[model samples]
Target: MAEETVSCPVKIHMTTEIFQEETEKIELVLFGHYYEKGGSAYLKYEEMQEAGKIHTVVKVASGRALVMRSGAVSMRLDLREGSRRPGTYENGYGQFPIEAAADEIVHTRTGSLSGQLSLGYRLYMHGDSVGTYKMKIHYEEVQAAK
Candidate 1:
Protein backbone atom coordinates (compact mmCIF):
# COMPACT_ATOMS: atom_id res chain seq x y z
CA MET A 1 0.00 0.00 0.00
CA ALA A 2 1.24 3.49 -0.87
CA GLU A 3 1.65 5.90 2.07
CA GLU A 4 0.59 9.54 1.95
CA THR A 5 1.32 12.44 4.27
CA VAL A 6 0.21 16.09 4.33
CA SER A 7 1.76 19.17 5.92
CA CYS A 8 0.77 22.81 6.12
CA PRO A 9 0.97 25.91 8.32
CA VAL A 10 -2.04 27.27 10.20
CA LYS A 11 -2.70 30.99 10.66
CA ILE A 12 -5.07 32.59 13.13
CA HIS A 13 -6.25 36.23 13.21
CA MET A 14 -8.60 37.63 15.84
CA THR A 15 -10.06 41.07 16.62
CA THR A 16 -11.38 42.22 20.02
CA GLU A 17 -13.68 45.02 21.12
CA ILE A 18 -12.99 46.17 24.69
CA PHE A 19 -14.43 48.91 26.88
CA GLN A 20 -12.08 50.84 29.12
CA GLU A 21 -13.59 51.59 32.52
CA GLU A 22 -10.50 53.16 34.14
CA THR A 23 -7.94 55.40 32.44
CA GLU A 24 -4.90 53.28 33.32
CA LYS A 25 -2.10 51.96 31.14
CA ILE A 26 -2.45 48.20 30.50
CA GLU A 27 -0.22 45.46 29.12
CA LEU A 28 -1.39 42.23 27.49
CA VAL A 29 0.00 38.82 26.44
CA LEU A 30 -1.33 36.44 23.77
CA PHE A 31 -0.34 32.80 23.34
CA GLY A 32 -1.54 29.29 22.37
CA HIS A 33 -0.52 25.79 23.53
CA TYR A 34 -1.29 22.58 21.63
CA TYR A 35 -0.38 18.88 21.81
CA GLU A 36 2.85 19.60 19.92
CA LYS A 37 6.20 20.89 21.12
CA GLY A 38 6.57 24.61 20.67
CA GLY A 39 2.89 23.91 20.02
CA SER A 40 2.72 26.25 22.97
CA ALA A 41 3.58 29.87 21.96
CA TYR A 42 3.05 33.43 23.12
CA LEU A 43 3.74 37.11 22.24
CA LYS A 44 3.89 40.38 24.17
CA TYR A 45 0.98 42.49 22.96
CA GLU A 46 2.31 45.59 24.67
CA GLU A 47 5.49 45.41 22.61
CA MET A 48 3.47 45.38 19.41
CA GLN A 49 1.80 48.67 20.31
CA GLU A 50 5.13 50.39 20.98
CA ALA A 51 7.33 49.05 18.21
CA GLY A 52 4.57 49.07 15.60
CA LYS A 53 5.59 45.57 14.64
CA ILE A 54 3.34 42.53 14.73
CA HIS A 55 4.48 39.80 17.18
CA THR A 56 3.95 36.33 15.74
CA VAL A 57 5.48 32.82 15.85
CA VAL A 58 5.48 29.58 13.86
CA LYS A 59 4.06 26.29 15.27
CA VAL A 60 5.76 23.07 14.31
CA ALA A 61 4.26 19.56 14.48
CA SER A 62 5.54 17.37 17.29
CA GLY A 63 8.06 14.90 15.85
CA ARG A 64 6.70 12.16 18.12
CA ALA A 65 3.15 12.26 16.84
CA LEU A 66 0.99 9.17 17.16
CA VAL A 67 -0.74 8.00 14.02
CA MET A 68 -4.46 8.28 14.65
CA ARG A 69 -7.57 8.24 12.48
CA SER A 70 -9.51 11.02 14.20
CA GLY A 71 -8.97 13.41 17.12
CA ALA A 72 -9.45 16.96 18.41
CA VAL A 73 -7.06 19.88 19.15
CA SER A 74 -7.61 22.61 21.71
CA MET A 75 -6.05 26.13 21.99
CA ARG A 76 -6.13 28.99 24.55
CA LEU A 77 -5.15 32.67 24.13
CA ASP A 78 -5.53 36.01 25.90
CA LEU A 79 -7.41 38.95 24.29
CA ARG A 80 -5.96 41.77 26.39
CA GLU A 81 -4.02 44.46 24.40
CA GLY A 82 -2.00 47.45 25.60
CA SER A 83 1.48 49.02 25.87
CA ARG A 84 3.98 48.30 28.68
CA ARG A 85 7.28 49.74 27.39
CA PRO A 86 8.85 52.49 29.45
CA GLY A 87 9.35 56.14 28.34
CA THR A 88 6.90 55.81 25.46
CA TYR A 89 3.22 56.29 24.81
CA GLU A 90 3.13 55.78 21.05
CA ASN A 91 0.63 52.95 20.47
CA GLY A 92 0.95 50.61 17.48
CA TYR A 93 0.21 47.05 16.28
CA GLY A 94 1.89 44.29 14.23
CA GLN A 95 2.60 40.52 13.91
CA PHE A 96 5.49 38.19 14.83
CA PRO A 97 6.61 34.56 14.29
CA ILE A 98 6.53 31.45 16.61
CA GLU A 99 8.47 28.16 16.49
CA ALA A 100 8.13 24.67 18.10
CA ALA A 101 10.87 22.11 18.79
CA ALA A 102 10.75 18.29 18.58
CA ASP A 103 10.69 15.65 21.35
CA GLU A 104 9.85 18.27 23.96
CA ILE A 105 7.36 16.04 25.80
CA VAL A 106 8.09 12.41 26.64
CA HIS A 107 4.86 10.55 27.41
CA THR A 108 3.33 8.10 25.03
CA ARG A 109 1.39 4.94 25.87
CA THR A 110 -1.34 5.08 23.20
CA GLY A 111 -1.77 7.62 20.45
CA SER A 112 -5.11 9.07 21.40
CA LEU A 113 -7.22 10.64 18.64
CA SER A 114 -7.77 13.75 20.74
CA GLY A 115 -5.54 16.82 21.30
CA GLN A 116 -5.74 19.74 23.73
CA LEU A 117 -4.06 23.19 23.84
CA SER A 118 -3.93 26.20 26.20
CA LEU A 119 -2.50 29.67 25.46
CA GLY A 120 -2.74 33.23 26.81
CA TYR A 121 -0.74 36.40 27.65
CA ARG A 122 -0.49 38.72 30.65
CA LEU A 123 -1.72 42.34 30.82
CA TYR A 124 -0.08 44.80 33.18
CA MET A 125 0.11 48.59 33.45
CA HIS A 126 3.88 48.66 33.13
CA GLY A 127 4.41 52.43 33.09
CA ASP A 128 3.02 55.99 32.70
CA SER A 129 -0.27 57.45 33.87
CA VAL A 130 -3.56 55.55 34.14
CA GLY A 131 -5.90 55.32 31.18
CA THR A 132 -8.05 52.87 29.25
CA TYR A 133 -7.66 52.08 25.55
CA LYS A 134 -9.76 49.78 23.37
CA MET A 135 -7.71 47.73 20.93
CA LYS A 136 -8.26 45.15 18.20
CA ILE A 137 -5.59 43.01 16.54
CA HIS A 138 -6.27 42.37 12.86
CA TYR A 139 -4.46 39.66 10.88
CA GLU A 140 -3.64 39.65 7.19
CA GLU A 141 -2.61 36.42 5.47
CA VAL A 142 0.64 36.86 3.54
CA GLN A 143 1.18 33.22 2.70
CA ALA A 144 -1.33 31.13 0.77
CA ALA A 145 -2.97 28.29 2.71
CA LYS A 146 -2.39 24.95 1.02
Candidate 2:
Protein backbone atom coordinates (compact mmCIF):
# COMPACT_ATOMS: atom_id res chain seq x y z
CA MET A 1 0.00 0.00 0.00
CA ALA A 2 1.14 3.55 -0.69
CA GLU A 3 1.70 5.87 2.21
CA GLU A 4 -0.65 8.76 2.66
CA THR A 5 0.92 12.21 2.60
CA VAL A 6 -0.31 15.08 4.76
CA SER A 7 0.77 18.59 5.60
CA CYS A 8 1.77 19.34 9.15
CA PRO A 9 1.50 22.81 10.59
CA VAL A 10 3.26 22.86 13.89
CA LYS A 11 4.02 25.11 16.81
CA ILE A 12 7.10 24.30 18.80
CA HIS A 13 8.03 25.74 22.15
CA MET A 14 11.27 24.84 23.82
CA THR A 15 12.66 25.76 27.21
CA THR A 16 16.14 25.16 28.47
CA GLU A 17 17.06 25.25 32.12
CA ILE A 18 20.65 25.38 33.19
CA PHE A 19 22.07 24.14 36.49
CA GLN A 20 18.66 24.58 38.11
CA GLU A 21 19.05 28.34 37.84
CA GLU A 22 18.84 29.78 34.37
CA THR A 23 16.31 29.31 31.61
CA GLU A 24 16.12 29.99 27.90
CA LYS A 25 13.07 29.67 25.71
CA ILE A 26 12.41 29.50 21.98
CA GLU A 27 9.13 29.39 20.13
CA LEU A 28 8.74 28.82 16.42
CA VAL A 29 6.03 28.19 13.87
CA LEU A 30 6.84 26.10 10.84
CA PHE A 31 5.26 23.86 8.26
CA GLY A 32 6.33 20.33 7.55
CA HIS A 33 4.99 17.12 6.09
CA TYR A 34 3.97 13.74 7.47
CA TYR A 35 4.06 10.39 5.78
CA GLU A 36 4.21 6.73 6.60
CA LYS A 37 7.00 4.76 4.99
CA GLY A 38 8.48 1.36 5.65
CA GLY A 39 6.30 0.91 8.72
CA SER A 40 7.42 4.17 10.28
CA ALA A 41 6.00 7.65 10.53
CA TYR A 42 8.18 10.55 9.41
CA LEU A 43 7.91 14.25 9.97
CA LYS A 44 10.17 16.75 8.21
CA TYR A 45 10.47 20.46 8.73
CA GLU A 46 13.01 23.08 7.81
CA GLU A 47 14.04 25.69 10.32
CA MET A 48 15.86 28.77 9.11
CA GLN A 49 16.95 32.04 10.56
CA GLU A 50 18.85 34.94 9.02
CA ALA A 51 22.20 33.32 9.77
CA GLY A 52 21.30 29.82 10.87
CA LYS A 53 19.21 27.03 9.39
CA ILE A 54 18.41 23.42 10.13
CA HIS A 55 16.07 20.60 9.23
CA THR A 56 14.19 18.61 11.83
CA VAL A 57 12.99 15.09 11.18
CA VAL A 58 11.04 12.94 13.58
CA LYS A 59 10.75 9.24 12.99
CA VAL A 60 8.59 6.89 14.98
CA ALA A 61 8.42 3.15 14.82
CA SER A 62 7.45 0.36 17.22
CA GLY A 63 6.68 2.73 20.08
CA ARG A 64 10.11 4.27 19.81
CA ALA A 65 11.04 7.65 18.38
CA LEU A 66 14.07 9.54 17.20
CA VAL A 67 14.40 13.22 16.50
CA MET A 68 17.09 14.18 14.05
CA ARG A 69 18.20 17.74 13.39
CA SER A 70 20.59 18.58 10.60
CA GLY A 71 21.93 21.38 8.44
CA ALA A 72 22.51 24.74 10.16
CA VAL A 73 22.96 23.21 13.56
CA SER A 74 26.32 22.42 11.96
CA MET A 75 25.82 18.85 13.01
CA ARG A 76 23.26 16.06 13.08
CA LEU A 77 21.76 15.25 16.43
CA ASP A 78 20.08 11.87 16.68
CA LEU A 79 18.02 11.94 19.81
CA ARG A 80 16.48 8.82 21.27
CA GLU A 81 14.86 8.20 24.59
CA GLY A 82 17.20 7.87 27.58
CA SER A 83 20.15 8.03 25.26
CA ARG A 84 22.96 10.55 25.00
CA ARG A 85 24.21 11.67 21.63
CA PRO A 86 27.24 13.80 20.93
CA GLY A 87 26.85 16.50 18.30
CA THR A 88 27.26 20.23 17.72
CA TYR A 89 25.04 23.26 17.86
CA GLU A 90 26.50 25.82 15.49
CA ASN A 91 26.32 29.53 14.98
CA GLY A 92 28.17 32.11 12.87
CA TYR A 93 31.10 31.90 15.25
CA GLY A 94 31.98 28.26 14.91
CA GLN A 95 31.13 24.76 16.10
CA PHE A 96 31.14 23.48 19.64
CA PRO A 97 30.65 19.99 21.00
CA ILE A 98 27.33 19.36 22.66
CA GLU A 99 26.00 16.20 24.29
CA ALA A 100 22.23 15.85 24.34
CA ALA A 101 20.63 13.35 26.69
CA ALA A 102 16.96 12.68 27.02
CA ASP A 103 15.55 11.28 30.22
CA GLU A 104 11.84 11.30 29.47
CA ILE A 105 10.27 11.49 26.03
CA VAL A 106 6.52 11.53 25.63
CA HIS A 107 4.77 11.03 22.35
CA THR A 108 2.13 8.99 20.59
CA ARG A 109 4.18 6.27 18.99
CA THR A 110 1.25 4.75 17.11
CA GLY A 111 -1.48 6.22 14.93
CA SER A 112 -1.43 9.65 13.27
CA LEU A 113 1.54 11.78 14.30
CA SER A 114 -0.28 14.73 15.71
CA GLY A 115 -0.64 16.54 19.03
CA GLN A 116 2.02 17.18 21.62
CA LEU A 117 5.62 16.06 22.11
CA SER A 118 7.49 16.63 25.34
CA LEU A 119 11.20 16.04 25.59
CA GLY A 120 13.08 16.35 28.85
CA TYR A 121 16.79 16.37 28.43
CA ARG A 122 20.09 17.89 29.48
CA LEU A 123 22.98 19.48 27.62
CA TYR A 124 26.61 18.98 28.43
CA MET A 125 29.53 20.99 27.10
CA HIS A 126 33.11 20.05 27.88
CA GLY A 127 31.82 17.31 30.19
CA ASP A 128 30.13 19.82 32.45
CA SER A 129 26.41 19.81 33.12
CA VAL A 130 25.45 23.07 31.47
CA GLY A 131 21.69 22.87 31.28
CA THR A 132 18.48 20.90 31.17
CA TYR A 133 15.79 21.38 28.60
CA LYS A 134 12.14 20.76 27.88
CA MET A 135 10.74 20.90 24.36
CA LYS A 136 7.06 20.81 23.49
CA ILE A 137 5.69 20.48 19.98
CA HIS A 138 2.12 20.50 18.75
CA TYR A 139 1.47 19.19 15.24
CA GLU A 140 -1.77 19.24 13.34
CA GLU A 141 -2.67 17.89 9.94
CA VAL A 142 -3.66 20.30 7.19
CA GLN A 143 -6.14 19.00 4.68
CA ALA A 144 -4.25 20.32 1.69
CA ALA A 145 -0.79 21.48 0.73
CA LYS A 146 -0.03 25.18 0.54
lDDT of 2 by residue, 16-131 (tens): 33445756677777777766677666777888867577887877655356667767565545566667788676666787888878776666533365666666677787888878
> What value does the lDDT take at residue 7 in candidate 1?
25
Best by lDDT: 2
Put down candidate 1 lDDT per residue, 40-109, tens digits, no spaces: 2221121243334443332223322211111121112222123222221122232222121221222221
Where does the lowest 10-residue lDDT sum fall in candidate 2? 10-19
Candidate 2 lDDT at 125 equals 79
Q: Which regions in candidate 2 have their CA more than 4 angstroms from the true location?
A: 1-20, 61-65, 109-113
Candidate 2: pairs in clash: none
